[model samples]
Target: LVHILSHSGLLLLRAGVQGLSYAYLTALVFLHISREGKRVSLPRALLTPVPSVPSPRRYMCSLSLFHYSEYLVTAINNPRSLSLDSFLLNHSFEYNLAALSSWVEFTLEKLLFPELKQITWLSTVGLLMVVFGDCLRKAAMLTAGSNFNHIVQNEKSDTHTLVTSGVYGWFRHPSYVGWFYWSIGTQVLLCNPICMVGYALVSWRFFRERVEEEEITLIHFFGEEYLEYKRKVPSGLPFIKGVKVEL
Candidate 1:
């Protein structure tokens, strides 16, 4: 009996340690992504002259493929950004810490108690969900380029053009949806109640804010044309009947 108790205690300790490690790793991922938005000021001597305005078609076609490629690389390397808050609570440091703690406790309890092993399936599902969600997100990001900003605080680029092809044709906010799913997937894989709740709150907040912000910008830039597109395409959910609007 004493040996069994000691083994149980050790298992619990290991679970707690694993939980804390996961939380810290996740936090670091978010921070790494967020820091990329800081703009480095170039010397005035390095500034290039702006060219005269060309026709819209000519301008669109003339955009350097190299510039787009660079943006894609930057986005992939630093994907999290300020949007981490959207996946976490508003003032979530304590909550995240709590989640880590709870996860550890739960993991420990499961190790000692045979009944807790049943929940392992849930974590497995979550792992699969996260993997699938990540693939979708990467695809969307590759298609969206600079139009996709993971940082909520950054100003939307003024140079954004109306992109109606690829994933954009199916859903207005595919990337955001991908992000939402990704968070859900993480919580599922971790199988922590605290993380699940935190994930839900953060995902909802970010999705709402991102949709509203993008819509406002689209309206401002595209005006009637955007309205028409919004009418036909669903906002977040894919393949649903969209609201009809006359441009």
Candidate 2:
């Protein structure tokens, strides 16, 4: 940041410092939230008030929610299988790439063309996407209970059952639906046009493949039951039709 300041100006320095601090604080909050010694019930934890984060920092809030919700929701629904990896927000290489790209685009745009970064309305829309997407994903996880897995299950377990109630009734892959929007939303929050487009395309392709792969296993597990559910509920992602079935 100091080096950037030498080349740029005090404002850039301030932005860099602020960004780092926000990230650091978010990590701290997560560590505190997920401390090994203390475990709180999901309901109580949900009721706990989170401190209000400022405008741009809401991006951090959304990110934090994205990570911690995965852990928390799974802990509630699939406690026996819960692990740190459940915090999928921080672990994916693709996720890190997307985040880095957003920061890079924001920084370059901020430096080269400051006025381009002032899209307040766009940021607002992005924040809405983040909130809605995150909430919807969490809801699907909750609805699925033990049925949800961060990884697609190739073999059905004794406890694994088809989920077709609640959010599942509305969308065959509500979790993926939520994630697809959230992935794109993060880039929008940063006002990174390039990352926004890239995130959307990448996320859509990834989910498209994932839903198809998972559906094959679902059919194997539940056959007509799964096919019937598929017929009724849309995949809920734009332009994704899941595995093509000849019926």
Candidate 3:
């Protein structure tokens, strides 16, 4: 009974956090598109096409590759980002079941996997990782401000330059690194041993693929400048002082 109540409360908390984040992002996207006007097409601007402009065919070709790559990466990372509303309206019992299935992960990890559920320093470390990592992730976004985006943007229009200082100084993609640890830490804090492994493996692959794609896009956009920055900075981590990956 206590376990059920606790899980229920955690689910509600997760829902609340996701709802607030979605609302905030919606508001930010609306404001940005409203101000950008025609350079970025309406609604379609979400996909980021510049069809209204005359034939700068070469630029368009590069942009088309960029936009599609960004879209694919977003879809891969967040399969529901663009279509959650339609899903909400059409959801059925199965959908609710799927939503509630998180408890199964919780149960399996906390109950069946004693190796994972044991109390250890990892619990404290995981707690700190979630808290500090989340804060750092937010700070990276806020620091970059409007320049921050899930989609790669043409640097020509953004108000900020390549973020090579601050969080950027910490790692080339500090936000991704923060999120990577933050996610792994979630399973640790939850005492879900199986999920800790799953999270670590899954997030590593996702981020590795995503990071590689992003660097390609960055090199395309920033040329030698980004290459130089890449050399100077390690690839976003608390691997920070000691380790560096030259992605």
Candidate closest to the true structure, highest TM-score: 2
**True-vs-predicted CA distance for residue 230, candidate 1, Å:** 1.4
Model 3's C-alpha root-mean-square deviation from the true structure amounts to: 19.2
**In model 3, where do residues sit more than 4 Å from their true spots?**
1-102, 109-120, 154-160, 237-247
| Candidate 1 accuracy as lDDT | 0.50
Q: What is the lDDT of residue 53 in candidate 2?
A: 26
lDDT string, candidate 2, 40-134, tens digits: 33333333332222234556556776776686677678866765456665457887887888888888988998776667778767777877898
lDDT of 3 by residue, 182-237 (tens): 66766555555566787677677767776777777777677789888887888864
Consecutive 10-residue window with the lowest summed lDDT within model 3: 54-63
Cα lDDT listed for each candidate: 0.50, 0.75, 0.53
| RMSD over all Cα atoms, model 1 | 20.1
lDDT of 1 by residue, 1-247 (tens): 4643353344435657653543443333323222135432221111212122111111111111212322334335433332222222333575456446645655675577635434656755654565456556666767766555544433445656677778878787776676567666665554556666776776676567657765776676778888878877777643323333343
Query: Candidates' TM-scores?
Result: 0.52, 0.78, 0.54
Q: Against the correct fold, how does model 3 do in TM-score?
A: 0.54
Candidate with more favorable, higher lDDT: 1 or 3: 3
Q: Pick the candidate with the highest lDDT.
A: 2
Root-mean-square deviation (CA) per prediction: 20.1, 11.9, 19.2
What's the ranking of the predictions by TM-score, best on top? 2, 3, 1
